[model samples]
Each structure stands twice: as structure tokens, then as C-alpha cells.
Target: MVVMWMVTGGAGYIGAHVVQAFLDEGMAVVVLDDLSSGHAEFVPEGVPLVRGSILDTPLVEAALREHGVDGVVHLAGFKYAGVSVQRPLHTYAQNVTGTAHLLEAMDAAGVRRIVFSSSAAVYGTPDVDLVTERTPTAPESPYGESKLIGEWLLRDAARATADDDAPLRHTSLRYFNVVGSGRPDLYDSSPHNLFPLVIEALLAGRTPRINGTDYPTPDGTCVRDYVHVADLARSHVVAARALEAGTSLEPVYNLGSGDGVSVREIMTTMADVTGIAFEPDVAPRRPGDPARIVASGELAARDLDWRMRHSLTEMARSAWEARRQA
Candidate 1:
């Protein structure tokens, strides 16, 4: 039988790319998105787009059963870290409660495999130069805390179902700065992410502002691991295949570049990619902003075929082109 997967939030930037990746692999997919932050237009034609929140247990369960979903890629959540700080209750409601509800529905529907879309925010401000799976988690934002809790939910659920005929197999991919676009029609529309912030500012003839220039880094700006959305999306397919094959995967894998790119460097690349010439306005550090957070994708690389397939220039250029098309 052909495996059918449900991509929650499948119309969002990353989720849409993941949906495309599944299609490229000849896998059947159905999307379940509330169109809250996701664009309905991003979901491709012929794929069923269930327009409902994952919080609706009956709706999700019915969708799962009706579609014969064998696995789920859970990406539906409140995603902004900064905004999450101001709206902790809202964040918890969407990410934490929403994940719990999805799990409940999956349990009811007998969907036994899941690939969770987690965040590096779960690590908060890591002192280590290269974050690994061993890095201690100290989530600073409610968004991060909620993602960590979601992972806990999966772990505890798997433990509870260990002896069952079909145990709940799962893996969480901890994303670090997912940028760029896999297709021109699908671009990051997030107001909070760096790529869209810079791209939107330039498109409006405004100089992009860097959050901080006094960070403890080579360029005095915050550093992060930037990964292309397509590359990140491809790994989700790999994880799904692993689960379907009953292959044991680590509970969590960091999908990262294993290298750091500073904010100023990104500014230069954006300028080069877009043919815009302007210096970024230096602003005070955003409170709670970490100086650096880069991670090694060795585990993901070994198991999920994860790697940096796109260069930094390609990341910036693809993002700019897609946003321009939008």
C-alpha cells in the first residue's frame, strides 16, 4: 500500500516545502492547516487541504481516518519567539495544547508514526560553540518551552505505547534558522524571521536594521546556523521513511549547518543577492537575544541524509527572488 502522510501546517513556508518534497519522492500527502499563518494557495492542486485547526480533535481524527494517514509531520504551531514572550498563553494554547490535541487524534486514528517540527529555540542561549543533541535545554521563550514540551509528549507517548502491537514511533527535527524557498510560489511571509525582515525592508527602500552589533562574535553581531528550506524539507521525508520502515531514529535530531553566519554577513549577502547597496542600521540587542547558536547536524546527516545543499548566497538569492515574485 502507498503510504499517506498528513502535514500539519502544510501550507506554511517550511511545511509547504516539506509537502513539495514528499511529492517529489512520489509520496501521497494531505495538508491540515487552519490558514492562520499558512497560505492556502501554497498547498498544491490535487492535495486535500483540510482547513481546520489541529486543536479540533474530532476534525483531525476524522481527517486522519478518512485519508488513511500513516504518518504525520507536525509543524502547526505559534512560531514567533519574541511575540511568544508577550503572548505566553496564546503560544501555549497553539503549540502545547495543539500538539497534545494532535497526539490525541493520532492515537484515536491509529496513526503510529510522526515527525515533529521542533526548534533550536529549545536550546535557548547555549554557551557551547557547537550545539549538539547533548546540549542542555533551557528554553527562554514560551515558544521554545512549548516545543520542548511537545517533544516530551512524543517521548512519553512512545514510552506508554512501547509494548503495543504498533508503538508510536517518532523523531523531532530541531530547526536552526530555516530560510530561503524551495519554490517561487512558496516564500517565508513571517514578519519576525530575518530573511523576510531584511527582504521586506529592502523592497520598501528602507535600510534593514540589525538587532545587535555588540555581540561577542567575530563581527560583533549575533551568529546563527542558516539552512535552506528545501534541504530542511527533504530531511522530513527521510525521517518519515525511516519511521515507516520501522528504523530506529534518535528521539531528536538537530537540522543545522554546523557553522555560524553573522547578521552583518547576511546583510552583505542580501545586498549582493538583491543588487541593493546600503548598510544596515545597528540597533540595540533585542532582550534575551543570544550572541550565538550554531549546531552540528551530524546525527541528522548520518541518519536523515541532512546536509547543507545550498550556499549562503543561494539562500539569500532564492529568498529574495521568491519574495519578489510574491
Candidate 2:
């Protein structure tokens, strides 16, 4: 019998890439998304997509049963870190409460395994140059706090159901910056993310502005690990496969590039790759912006075959092509 997986928020950018990655491995995929931030076209043909929120327990549970879902890739949540600070309740409703509801549905349906799309925000501006799985979690925003809570919820659920025949096996992926595009039709549509913001500005014939050119980094700008979306997507599939085979895995993995690129370098690469020859305007740093925070992907590399396959130039070029197609 073939294994089937349900991808919540699979109509979004990262989720769409993850669906493709699973398809590449010959796993049957079904996507669940409310189309709030996700476009229906992003979902590939032939993959079953259910248009609904994960909070809708009956809807989520029905999708699982109807599709014979063996596992789930939970990716649906409100993800804007900055805006989450102002709208804490809304963030909690979507990420925290929504996660609780999904777990409830999973339990009701006896779904045994899940791969969660967590964020490095759980680390909340780490002090270490290379954050490990042991890094202390101190989320700075409601969004980060909600993701950390989601991780805890999964753990608690696993413990509660350990004695059952269908024990919950779960792993959360943590990363800082996700960029680039896997296909021409799919591109990052986030308003707050760096790559999309820059790409959109240039396309509108406006100069892209870089926040904080006076940070303590070598380039006097903030530095972050920007991983290619395709590479990140592949790791998600590997994690799912491991769970399907009843292989034991750590509770979490950081899909980070040990080293990182500064915002200035990103701008330069975009200019070179797209032949947009205008210099970016330098702006003051946003509040609570870290000077540098890159995590060690060693754990994920060992367990999930994770690695940064694309260079900065390649990431920029692919994203540019996708944006043009958008």
C-alpha cells in the first residue's frame, strides 16, 4: 500500500515546495489550506487540495480519513513576526489555538506522525553564532512564542499517547531565513520577508531599502542564514520518510547554514543577477533586530540529509525568475 500525507497550508510557498518534494519521492500528497495567504494555483496538478482552515476539526479530520492519511506536514499558521507583536491575540488564535485544534484532530483520527514547520524565532535572537538543538528558547514575539508552544503541544501529545498503538511521532524544523523559489510559477509572497520585499521593489522600478547599515557585522548590516526553499523542502520530505519507516528522530532540527550572508551582500547579488543597477537606500535598523544569528545544521544534516545546495547568486536568480513569472 502507498503512504499518503496531508500538507496543511500546502497552498503557500514553502508548503507548495514541500508538496513537490514529497511527490518527487513518490509519496501521495493532499493539501489543506484556507487560501488566506496562499494562492490556489501554487498547488500542483493531480495533488488533492482541500480548501479549509486547520482549526476546523471536522473538516481537518474528514480530510485525513477520506485520504487515508498516514502522516501530516503541519505548516499552517500566522507567520509575520513583526506584526505578531501588535496583534498577539490574532497570532495566538491562528498559531497556538489552531495548532491545538489540529493536534486534537490528529488524535481523533489516529494519525501517528507529523513534521512541523517551526521557525528559529523560537530561539528569539540567540547569542550564539551557531545555535544547536540545545539552544535556550526565549521567543521575543507572539509568533515565536506560539511556535514554541506548538512544539510543546506536540511533545505533550506524544507523551500522553505513548502507550497507545498509534503513538505520536513528531519533529519540528527551525530555521531563520528561507528564500529563493523552486519553480517559476511559485514565488515568495510575504510582505515582510527580505527577498520578496527587495524583488517587489525593484520590479516596481523603486529602489530597495536595506534596514540597518550600521550593525556590528563586517558589512555594517545584519547577517542571517538564507536557505534555498528547495533544499529546505527536501529536508522536510526526508524527515517524513524517516517517521514513516518508524525510525527514531530528535524532537527538532535546525535547517540553518552555519555561515550567513549580510543584507548588503544580498542586495549586491540581486543587482548582479537581475541587472538592476540601482544602489539600495540604507535605513535605520528595526527594533530588536539581531546583529547576527546563524544556526548549525549539523544535526539536520546527519538525520535529514540537509545541506545548502544553492549559492546566494543562484537563490537570487531563481527568486527573480519566479517573481517575473508571478
Candidate 3:
């Protein structure tokens, strides 16, 4: 009895890795993506790529039924935090409204489980050094607000259907900065991500610029937790397996590495991996940029088999190789 899971936004960078992780474990998967930010070529052959948005209840419900989907890994949405500030309505429409519609379709089609793709943006600039699951959520951007709302939707939906036969069982994984490549054929194509921004600049014969080199950190630069996309993807499968086996899980899990790497360190590593030795340009700090934001993945480690399998060097090298090949 092989369980079939539908991965929304599976054609994107992180989603593609998740799809591959499921397939690697001999589980079956299907992808539903609108190709707005996802690339069709990133989707592996032989896996059904349903071209649609999660907002379309009829379309999502049809796909769930037509494929006999037992669970869903919801990852589709407008994910840019900075841009979300300017386009709050669009962000809410896609993330909050889209999640609501997905849940509705899941209920209509009797899909009982889901693993939502959440973000660390839910905790906006925490004063603490290491973020835990219990940190207060104070989202600054519309993107973060939408994600928090998505989690609420899942929680409330589960509460509402608790007495039902197939009560909804779900968990939201709040991601930090997901980087690196699981496969060379698949790479991060986002223009906003730090890894890609640096890669793109180096490729075009330009120096990578580091924003805010005056923070109160070891290197006077912002420090952030960077997790390998593949590592993060593997945990999604573990969480789904737990749900399928009737194992109870927390409503939300933070997928973090409990380690902080400074922007200066990242630039140095990028230089080492790419074999481009040049100093990075220092620029003024971006507004609202926190000095550091790392998290303890102890809970996820205990429950979801989460671990940092790759080092900072591996992350930089893999990302550079994938981008170079692309």
C-alpha cells in the first residue's frame, strides 16, 4: 500500500527537492504548480505535473480525486518577504486565501493529512539569540502574516474536524534560509535569495555586495541560519510518514540548524567554493535586518529525524555548482 502524496509547487527549488526525497524513499508523488516561479524542467519525468493554482478549488479537488491523493505537501505561495510589504493584498490572496481554498478542497476530497510550508518570517526580528518553537510571532511583512494565517487555518480546521472520522491531521514546518542543491539539474532560481544573488553577480563578473557590515555580531554583519534544501525536504517526508502512521505531532516545527553563520563568512565561503577571490563590497544595513536569527532544531531532531547533514562549505559549493551548470 504505497501512499501517494501531492506536492503543491513541486516544480520549484525546495518543492522539487521534496518530490525527489519522496521518490528516493520509494514513495509516490505528484506535483501541482502554476509555473509562476517554478520551472517545468525542474519536475522529474514520469511524475504527473498538474498545471494549476491551489486557489482553484475545482481544479485542486479534481487533481486530488483524479490521482487518489492520500496527503498533500502544500508549498505554493508568494514567498518574497520584502515585496510582500508593497503587495499585501496579493500576498494575502495567494498565501492566506490560497491555503484556505486548498484546505477546503482537501476536506471535500477527504484528504486527511498535509504538511504546510511555513517561514521564519512569522517571528520578525526576535531579540533572542536562538529562536525556539515557543518564540513570540510578530510578523513584520505581509508574507509572514500570511504564513501565520495559513498555520491558523490548519489549526482551526483540525480543531473543527476533530470529532469527524477522518479528522484533519497536519503540521507546519517553518523554514529559515533554505539553500544548496539536491541535484545539479535543479537549482535555486530566485533573484532575491542570498546564494543565488551572489552566484549571479559572480557569473556576471561583478563583486557580491554585503548589506550592513555594522551589526553587533562577531563580524559586524548579519548572521542567519542556512539549511540545505535537501535536508529540509527529507524532514517533510518524515513528518508525512508520522501523520500516516497515526503519530501525533506538534502544530508547528521550526526547521533550523541551531547555528549562525555571518554574511561575511558566507561571502568568504562563496569565494572559496567558486574559486573567485575578491573582497565583497560593504553596503549600508538593510532596514529591519536583525543582527542574528538562529533556531534550535532539537524538537524536529527528536521527532522528524532532522539533522544538519551538510556543512557551510557544502552548501556554498553545491549551490555554486548547480548555478554554474544552469
Most accurate candidate by TM-score: 1
- What's the ranking of the predictions by lDDT, best on top? 1, 3, 2
TM-score of 1: 0.99
lDDT of each: 0.95, 0.92, 0.93
lDDT, candidate 3, 1-326, per-residue tens: 87899999999999999999999999999999999999999989999999999999999999999999999999999998877877899999999999999999999999999999999889988889889999999887888889999999999999999999889999999987899998999999998778998999999999999988888899899888899999999999999999999998999999999999998899999999989998999887664456778888989999999999999999999999998899
Clashing pairs in 3: none
Model 2 misplaced regions, further than 4 Å? none
TM agreement with the true structure for every prediction: 0.99, 0.98, 0.97
Candidate 2 lowest-lDDT run of ten: 284-293
Clashes of 1: 0
Go through the candidates in order and give the clash count of each: 0, 0, 0
Model 3 ranges with Cα > 4 A deviation: none
Off by over 4 Å in 1: none
lDDT of 3 at 65: 97
Q: Is candidate 1 or candidate 2 better by lDDT?
A: 1
